[model samples]
Target: MVARRNWAGNVHYAARRFHEPTSVDELRRLVAGSDRLRAAGTGHSFNRFGDTTGDLVSLAGLPPDVTLDRDRSTVTVPAALRYGDLATALHAQGHALANLASLPHISVAGAVATGTHGSGVRNGNLASAVAALELVTADGDLLTLDRDADGDMFAGAVVSLGALGVVTRVTLDVAPAFTLCQYVRLGLAREALDEALDSAYSVSIFTDWRTPLLREVWVKQHAELPPPPAGWLGTTAAETPRHPVAGLSPEHCTPQLGPPGPWHERLPHFRLGFIPSSGDELQSEYHVPRAAGADALAALDEVAHLIAPVLQVCELRAVAADRLWLSPNHGRDSLAIHFTWVGDAAAVTPVVAAVEERLAPFSPRPHWGKVFGLAPAAVAAAWPRYADFLALMVRLDPSGTFRTDLLDRYFPRP
Candidate 1:
């Protein structure tokens, strides 16, 4: 069998066989027959979170049953549906999600399962939008969990990291469609991030960490709100469109320079039709308390020299607190420090360690789907509800049918 690698060509799945079932019945049979199984979606993860030694399944072949409930203000979508497609469909019907990650090509189930997020001081991670979800557990029995009905368990299940079972469908809360405008500021000073984060609906600051000045600040503001000042924070607006990573062509990026557009178009940094970021790159992100944003920056600045050689670009964004058990921004408002590293794992691994060490004082929580070298013990200590999530995992799949090597290492079964 030809080896299947992840989007970044980083993790090659070790599944003995790969299956793509076209219907729910077919998927159920596949899951029931396999002693161990794991489901993959869009292959966007940088690590082995989706890998298994047993059979592997992909839900992409399942029918995208997008159902919208106007009264309830929710949309139940197939797990395999991409965010970009979902956003377009919602906008046509005068609805929209609260926010979107930088890249819209990711599967909704995959993104939410791993606690993926977009930037905004008041916005929660993608998983927080899950009002309900359907998953086929180890016994091939379909189970549905609702945010209001399930209470604490639902919070734990939304960000399961593929441990409980294969999420088949998700019901997400929606809002009235809105418009926003994108603007890019060049050469922003490092200390001005807090002010800038609150200046727009969503903001992303990008830098290479070699200097005190940030490379670019991309702001998405509500069209109804007043526009940002022309020369705010000693920064000048970019005359033309710009990419997050310096020197890369801006053709793949979303429109900039303050033209009003639908929320779907402006919220994400990259256009859905194009590959996001440097396609050949490795990513790592950490969430620290928003209160420590400045101190976290200072900590990393001490190791800037170590990060510069292997770094492509780094991003800083804010995320509001949530109740999700495993979400990085679980208890406190957060500042997500993201790293896009050169594809070379050998060169990047040590740098990542140095970064984790630097941010240790802030009790940083690593992004579940990204590459990180944090020890299992350190990871467990970071999340207040880690043990609760483990209990939920066992309750849903006691046989460990969905467990992978990565899951076993971080959440070892008793």
Candidate 2:
């Protein structure tokens, strides 16, 4: 059999067998019979979190089962469905999700499980929108957990990293469809970062760290708001389209230049039809308290010389706090500093470690789906509810059927 690799082609799965079950019954049977298994979603994660030595299952073969409850303001979808497809379905019905990650191509289950997010000071990470989810556990039993009914355990489960079981379905909060306009500004001063971030409904700052000035500032504002000023913070609006990563074609990016568009179209940085980001790249992100945003940038600046060489681009965005135990933005309103590095792991690995070391003072929590060199203990210490999540994992998956080497490292079996 051929090898299976993730979307970035950085990590290869070690599963002895791969299974695609067309029905929940078939998926249950596969889970019950296997000594060990791990569910693979769109394979967008860059790490080994989805790797296993036993069986690997993909839920893409199952029915999408998209259902919207206008009364409850929620939408239920199959776990494997991409956010882009789900957004299209929701928008068609005159509804929309509160927020989406930069790349809408990710699977709902994977994105939620790993605490993926989009840019906005008031927006919570994607997992914060989960209202309920259904999963098949080690015993082949279908279990459903609701945000309101399950309380703390549900909070712990939302960003579970696939340790509890295979999430098959998810119900997310929705809102009336809305529209927004995207604006791109160039050459923002470093000191004006906070004001620029809060200047719009959703904002993204891009820089290569080679200069003191920010290279690009993408502002996404609600359509109802007045147009941005001709010149603010000494930054000029882009005369033409711009890519987050310098020099790349802007064709893949979502519409920009202050034209009003659907929330789904303007909220995400990339268009649904295009491959997100530069496809051949490795990503790493850390969330520090919003109050520490400036300090965090200064910390990263210390290592800018090392980072700029291997980096494609660096983005800084904000995310509101949420209750999800494993989420990087948990407890504290956060400033997410994201790095898009060249695909060469050998060269990029040390830079990642250096970045982590510089940001260690702020107790940064790394995005679970991305590349990071932080030690297991350091990572566990960053999450206050880490122990609670570990206990919840053991109670739900006693036999560890869903366990992977990555999970085992952070959450050791007693």
TM-score of 2: 0.98
Task: Give the per-residue lDDT digits (tens) of candidate 1, residues 1-414.
Answer: 223878899888888898888998888888888888998888889999889999988898898889999999999999989999999999999999999999999999999999999999999999999999999998888999999999988989999898998899999999999999999988999779899898888999999988899888998999987767878998998999988888889999889998999999999888899886545899999999999999999999889999999998999999999999999989999999999999999999999999999999999999999999899999999999999888888888888899988899999986
So what's the TM-score on candidate 1? 0.98
Q: What's the lDDT for residue 409 in model 1?
A: 94
Candidate 2 structure lDDT: 0.92
Candidate 1 minimal-lDDT segment of 10 residues: 1-10
List pairs with backbone clashes in candidate 1: none
Supply candidate 2's per-residue lDDT for 195.
Answer: 95
Give a tens-digit lDDT track for model 2, residues 51-73: 99999998899986899998989
TM-score of each: 0.98, 0.98
